[model samples]
Target: MKKITPANLVPLLTAALPEKDMAHILNALVQFLRDGGVKRASQRFDLLLDAFKQNPELAREFGTRFHRWLGSIHIYPALVGLGIFSRSGFAREMGIRIYERFMPSFKDLNNLRDVFLYLFQRQNDEKWLHTVSLLQWLSLYDTLCRHSDPAAVQTASRHLEQARLHALEMLSIWVAAEELEPEFTRLEPKLMEVDSAFVALHQEISRLVAHYRSGQTEHYDTAHIAVMMEQCRAQVERLRRKGTGAGAGSSVKVAHLLERLSQTLDRLAVLLDIQTAPDEKECRRHCVRLLNSLTTAAVEQHSTELLRRRSINMLAKSISENTSGHGEHYITRNKREYFAMLASAAGGGVIIALMAGNKIRITGLGLGDFTTAFLAGLNYGIGFMFIHIVGCTVATKQPAMTAARIAEHVEHKAGARALESKLAKLLIDVARSQAVAVFGNVVVAVIVASVVAAAVAAHTGAPMLDAHTAAYQFKSLQPFTQPTLWYAAIAGVWLFCSGIISGFYDNRADYLNLRKRLTVQPLLKRLLPARPRAFLADYLHRHYGSLAGNFIFGMLLGMTGWFGHLLGLPLDIRHVAFSSANLGYAAVSDHSGFLYFLLNLAFVLMIGAVNLVVSFSLALTVALRSRGARIESLSKLIDTLWLQIKANPLSLLFPVQPPAAAGGNGNGGNGSSANGKAKE
Candidate 1:
């Protein structure tokens, strides 16, 4: 007959039983063995164990299956050893009952001890490695039981001492291994010292308990206990620093050991139930300082690594996308349109400036006056035109880019068409709003400038400049001076041409393909090197239109001079003849030409300052409003992305489902998880 041993019974019973039933069987066996029924247990154990002994194949199969079950939770090494003995005759006859009684209770403790020993032993065997992982889990239950029962402190303290001794012995074995060099060798002596200190502490506690049990009063030295804890904390900090400089393998081992040691110390402290002392507080403060230093270093290291990885990953993704067929096409088209618009706007402004300069030079003006007037006119005209062009472009194109990105995100989903529809609507709304704001602002600025000119004409008793110029004939330039009405007609035509160009450029650059195809400033150019020069380049590019607008404003001021002169009003020749001169004359006759010049000077300075401040303030209000809207939109988009991630994390790597569908699933999934079944 086969022997009734712990090893044979364990596999046989656990093979066919569920976890709860297996636990129950082990518990019963432990109780029976503890009751001293070794002989009686032998007969029953042999009958159950024969199935495993009869066929080596069956035994192997059962072992494999049982190991898988044990892997699900922690099991003791002694239990496993006992199970092996159940199949041997001598073991069953001599030690079967004793093994059965103690193995179950000691299972958790033995498993934990084995895991520590395995790390020291440096076993590379797969089976051993798997078994060690299972054992670590079992140790938690062992620690938990001891922590919960105050009355069992004495017993728990004894068990911890034994565990520490086992750990120290294992450390010694590792130190002897040549493969485990300077690091393990250094740690071994320290671990031994710690083990001795802990044992002494345990013994003192035991002595105190024994004295109490013997009806003698005993006082425990809480201060001494606190000092020991402080020492342990200091050791932990030293080990942490050493571990940081150690080789990777040694570092990992040291970190694991330190973690376990910390847990053990915490358990011991709880068992001691030490009261607070002034020195204890000081020790705690020191510990906090040490921990904070280590924690900060680790956090900074982790953050840097994370950022580096993200940057590398983004670059790689961008490179790959640029290489792809569709990606190349999209980029090419986008660049082409972007540059085309920028070139057209800049070229047109240069043409207008050149044209106006030629006309002024032909009028027989001095070089100084011509140069100043040309520069002022060029700045005003170009600045005005550029603002409308760039503002409209940004408003239209930014939304389109955003929409395309969103559409790509949802392209593979079931409701992709619906998503596309919604995105289209959003783009249209953004474009329309932008067009209205740009056009409306331009119209208002023109009207305000015209109204101010009209008011000046009425006050100065000047005929409308347009009327007087029509009647005059300059002998030197009779060919050019057809009529003031003709000049007004020409100005109207130029204004219309400028508006058409601005709108066309703004609309054309809004497409993704067109934006990339224009070689204005590539994303890489913006990204590659940190150059102060590049910032200057971007600034110049963004505000180049403003200079054009300023030139146009100056031209309009010059035109007002002709209107003043044609009305038989005083001319501010010093100030180049503009309606600003009218402000100098409150009394009709006292409005000298020199006073008109001063008036123009003061008005230009005052209006420029006031308009600049008001315009900047308005821009800030617009920017803040836009930021708040963008933040709210981004919040919604982020929530949608998170829902998609949760529904199917793989979707992030490859398109599995649309964001909309995932959002629906997320709401449904959350409801079900919280309330026990998804609604609808």
Candidate 2:
């Protein structure tokens, strides 16, 4: 038989608990051991459970100790206030953190939470606390209740009555707040009467709790209250469905509030169930679920996960959804669409080449680092802005936007097979579109830079780049010898940031009703005719986010080198399209041999690979996480991709033409193409 041992989490069961405070308890914990080492949470639980099964004497002592601690502290707050009804935002929590940093909140034993926290104040407490299953917790709870002192059990039950009342109060407050929120009001203009149901439930539950507390033995009619709860939940569900629709009114705060409302409703249901249960068995089941929930709340309270749980996913969904509409346009579907992408990319290449040349002229001005950076930023920013105005594609900008589009597809809750098939096809199209776009940008950028370099040389009677500068450019391309990949990764991160910035601005426009405001402006009404005013407002409304994104992205890229110089750090950006243009200038000016230039071109492509991999990975992660979807079977998706690649290479590269004209299977996707744009 296994030897009996106390659970690592068998809190307040030792000599330390009766005599010591939290600080002293913490000091004593270091001396606690199992197998001459710290036991894992699961192992410790199994050990304690074994002791309960085999050693009744030790079990009784543990149960008594547990009840003693519980009876001493108010257990209601842990049930009512934990992990439910966070109507307040993160700023309030941040203020609390700041206040706690200077002056802590755990000084007084406010409730059972304080005692629980004080008892298990070790760093690894939450690790074991969270990982333990409901059954384990239930088994322990059942045993403790059975073996605990009758007086202590009676005392704990009284505290539980206060917890029930508080839970009802929280439910009522949340329902009231939801009714007042503009976001929910917009979803249900008629006001779905949830607050009334919650109020009724609150009153009914309060009466039932009182009846139990007053030692009434009559059967309480809670059936009406349960029905009210169902109706309220249905109304909440309807609002949630409306919220998820592809509309303009949705925001992160709304999503968070909706999530919180749903959680509070469920939590209140559990509390209600514990009281109105038809039998002891039913009551125990409800009690077990409540215990598990409080465990989760306790674990999260001690970890950074509480903040993460509050808002990160909601913010991600907002950002991803905002970018998805624009991201769709940045893909090519057919030969016509591919050529259109190429054309747009070529236009971007021309502008980038001119921008690079202007940078050379700007560098020669002998300005300070800050001035150079500022002027260069304007040069790049204005050039990128022009590219956007002209509907041109900068290949490096594709990853950030395209990744968001891919995430939109992944956001579905369809069957895994269907999702995998849909995603695989979309991925192939995105890859094909990206490939041609990059080809157009790199090849055309190199050509334009070469022509401009030769023109400068012919006019000035010298190469545009001096021999010394050309040499430095050459060295910068060698990945093995220099940090070219690192710089490319920095560029990728900036690209992702630009996508997020674009999404954020778009969300702001929607939230602020910027388009509507612009149309109704007092100045515009007097200065311009309605037709022109409407057109101007409409155009800016649709395009403002992208334009802002491009300008900021350009500024980021342009100012990086100057920042590196000023900070004495090795920081810079290396975009694939821009770097290709630089390589072209170096080749033409330095009069380098073909083989060495070709080698450098290969290295530039490697830099492009790093850029795509990093940016796409980051964007994809954010996109997937935002939607709460997991691509569970990677091997299956990889297999599907392989099959597609093997079946029709052309389908993966070019759009599949109609079967009648192409004399082939109808497997290739001939979907409608979105006219591609990106620096655009």
Candidate 3:
């Protein structure tokens, strides 16, 4: 095979490349590269790159599709491993290029939202949290540049307020939780001491905002901000010591205090100018101060506080914790079964509802005005039962398994290095499962809508027999007919929307929380017992899994309208199906018995199916993607182990030995002998 170059593969990728083919190509490229067919490998690689460069739309579509496929397979771990082997400078360079390509368009709010989301996903796999942090800072800085515009400033002000509110809420939650802990009994006073400091930080931010609003440049002085920050750090330090002490409640109090302090610091950092180099420096200085404060307050100072200690120790414990007993059992027995059962029950309910509603309509029932109402009731009841069963099942099962897997994976001796590789793959599997679930729901919704619509059209002439005219007559029922349809349609649409929103948000949030746990002091301590530096280096790799989830979820959401249309359902049924007939006119025109029941039945099915398919598909895709990522990540991790071993045989024993020296001479023996002995 000829060496594929960026230029050569562009046409193929641009021409709606199939996913299977894409994967095959990638596999081939990998093999070719391994076999020293660099020219062929490069040709293919260049084809992809050229395609991306020449056609923005194609680039976007290809990127999105590729990302989706990767997400579905939970292939982030392999990518992460690739990234790790590729070298930091190269990764950083690619990251920078990505940023440049997308940053220009981010001036628009929607674009900004997209960019933020994109950056968020990038944060998952790329060793670039600091880079992302920088980008976010810059984005905000750009927004601030338009400070001269009242509307812009107002927007910024709004965002700033929201950030503050979030910080406050987090602080409150942390504080309340801490106060309940036994260790906080003695540390209460020390915790209180920092309250004033927090108050001051809040006040300073408020003052800075006011100063900026009033047109006083000096009011945003970095020096004064630095001083307040220093004080906040000192107070935080004191609180840390208090909580870390021997008092039974100290640990709890300290954890709460540190959490609050961290939030406050984050808020403060956001409020400051961070555009220029100097501004960035100031921001970093303050950030470091806050980090130091958190470290001192929560970790170093509270070393003895069991709660505080536990906070730090939990990661390690989680990693090392045995899964052979309850953990494993919970995952396999309780978790999987629960989700599976829920899915089955939910699916069954929808099927039953459709069948029942059809049967009722088909049977020429004599129940006059009550028929439509009865059908609606039946539909809702069935829908609720299905949703409840599935929801409960998912709730009971997946989380425990997820936690257990994470614990087991991170605890293995080689877990830290392997974690990055595995995390992405796991995430991808979860994402794919979630996508499948979403797709399934979409299919169900479409099917139900089509079925109901067909049924309604067919049953336009059923008999209306029983009931007092005053209570159950056509006029009285007329008002409800359209509204009920509207309600169902609206509910369906809402479900679809909710699925998209929740899936993306939850996936991203999970990744961020995981990243935070992995990077944060106590958690980091537990997860990276052998090599903290290696853990940090690989952190970005793990993050990619989450990014993959977000991208996939978003893509799925984008396709909802198209999918709905494909499924033979109207995206908006309000105008066509539920537009209220002239109120006074509808009463006189549509009093016929059979027509109304059919309409009601149709609406019911449409609503039920829409809700079912959308919700289920969203859930399933997420799960699949996450699982796939985990599996792939584990595989790549083995490869990473081998690579590390090959690169430096002696360093295998001393995993903690610095990479710089280990990679340089190949025989440096500082800590290598001890490490080798330990391994032996």
Candidate 4:
């Protein structure tokens, strides 16, 4: 294998270039090297060096001619006040050098583009990639705009316009071809609609042109005309990716269409007066934006490229899909299911009480703060995992999951009125489910903690929580005077984050076939009996995301307070069920008055509300954004919710009984009742 060097390209460059221009090119090269500074110049020096070596006589002649244009090469004049040594200044200087010497005429630029096209065909060579990148062309254009004369700008614009024209011709030919009938069949209606709109726009433009010619330009609607043109442009773009497998004729036709569309859009942009903006920088910004939109429409229509462009949205959508099962479980459609949710939540509340009591012990251990946090994290994580494995529901975890389901419903529902009505009913279902879960968790957690406290005091001859500890617990649960509610919101944020993580991992598991891979692991075979190994793999396949989410949620709650202490900020998590349990322990230990106990309990409920609301709001926002669903204004949502409440007064608080079975021709029909029972 031979080592590649700059000198190896000398013969190629010499063969490609005109001998008469070699002296001017060499002189410009020396100036470019001097003015552009060593670092950037060094990167391109090898290419210039190789080309110079092609004709020694030309290089010698260029050396004598170099001084004549040395001053012209310094396009960036030093201005201390304006900061001469900047990116724009450097681009300007480089642009002028290339303009005056390397491409002194339009023919030279055309030759360069042709060479680029030829080299691009052989792009397997790594160097070609660098040469063909759009950044280089864009930089040259920017430099010409900054430092070159009107003639230079006209030359560049003419090239772009020519390219634009070619794309149009190609597209028109492709659309009119007989072989394109199948693809065009699907697109014909949309094309007709867009074309009609364009025809109308043309008529309007004709009138505007006449009005301008008659010296009555003030009557013209430029903004409206711009908007119509924009709509037409968008319609054209939507068709760009409709078909595949282009023959030579079709390829040429499609290429023409693309060029024509570009030219049309550019003409409209110029008419919009983007080039004549009051500020040059603002004009450039608009120009860039217009160019970018055109370029994106030209190239990004392929189905495969859409994935690369919208990767984040797709990832989020995948996560939301994973949470659908959990979300559906939160909406109880009958009395039986409603009670089941309550029972599940109550069971989860009992586990929470146990975890809270254990956490107090872990914190009381004379361990350092982080060590204690770590232990607490493990305790909470394992406790939550047990709750999940046992099929119990945590009241707070439902919001993040359910939000995605609601967003999905919003997307699939047909009309605005139908969607509104369905969305209203969904809110009723959500509200009832949330009300029952909160009731279950807070009531059961407090009762369980009170019983446990009483039992411990009776046996140990000491209160479950000592006086100082009880006071601290009471203080932490206080919402208004203390920062507890803020901590509750922090917990809500963590809940949102944990949901995202769960969805992310679930998507990863599906995408990467994690369970399939796990089943084949040698460690599983070595560590377990056959049946147990099979069970473990199957269980992990189904439950891995749920377990991981709960464990991480627990860890976040456990570490937050300790993290806060370290930062000297009042950062902590106030989970509703845990706070209620703590309140019960405090009340029992401190022997608080009824009023004070009631106030603390109220605060606990308020904290839970904040947790649920914050988490649900964030999750819904993400879910809707991922699905490209527009969220309604708050007032409209509230109004719809109120209408739903008025329409079905009892549905949001209690399950509605199924309607009576129809008596058609006296035939016995129990279908509705059976369906209702099935739902339960």
> For model 2, what is the C-alpha lDDT against the true structure?
0.73
Per-residue lDDT of candidate 2, residues 383-437 (tens digit): 8878888888888778888898887787663465577767777788888878887
lDDT of 4 by residue, 1-680 (tens): 54435475454344433544433443343344443343444445544544445545534433333322222222111111011111122234345434544444332211322222222222122222223234433443344344434454555444433333333333223222312333333433444443444554565555554564464425445666667667656655544433211110112233234334444545445434542355555655565554444333322221222322233344456577666545766776566677877888888889988988999888888899999999999998889888878877788887888787788887667347566767876778787888888888889999999889999999999998899999999989877689888999999999888787776666555544466667678998788777777777767766667788888988998899899999999898999989999988889888889999899989998999999999999999888877678645557777887886876688888877324412221212321221211110
**What's the true lDDT of residue 389 in model 4?**
81
**Would you estimate the TM-scores of all the predictions?**
0.19, 0.82, 0.25, 0.57
lDDT of 1: 0.34
Model 3 Cα lDDT, one tens digit per residue, 591-676: 43656645543443444444344433443333333223233354675666566556655332222234574355333222222111
The sequence of per-residue lDDT tens digits that candidate 1 reaches over residues 119-172 is 222112222222222223233223333233343434543444343333333322
Best model per lDDT: 2
**Cα distance off (Å), candidate 4, residue 540:** 1.3
Task: Report the Cα lDDT for residue 38, model 3.
Answer: 29
Model 1 root mean square deviation, Cα atoms: 28.5
Error of 3 at 625 (Å): 34
- List the candidates ranked by TM-score, beginning with the highest: 2, 4, 3, 1
For model 1 the local lDDT of residue 131 reads: 25
Q: Using lDDT as the measure, what is the rank order of every candidate, best first?
A: 2, 4, 3, 1
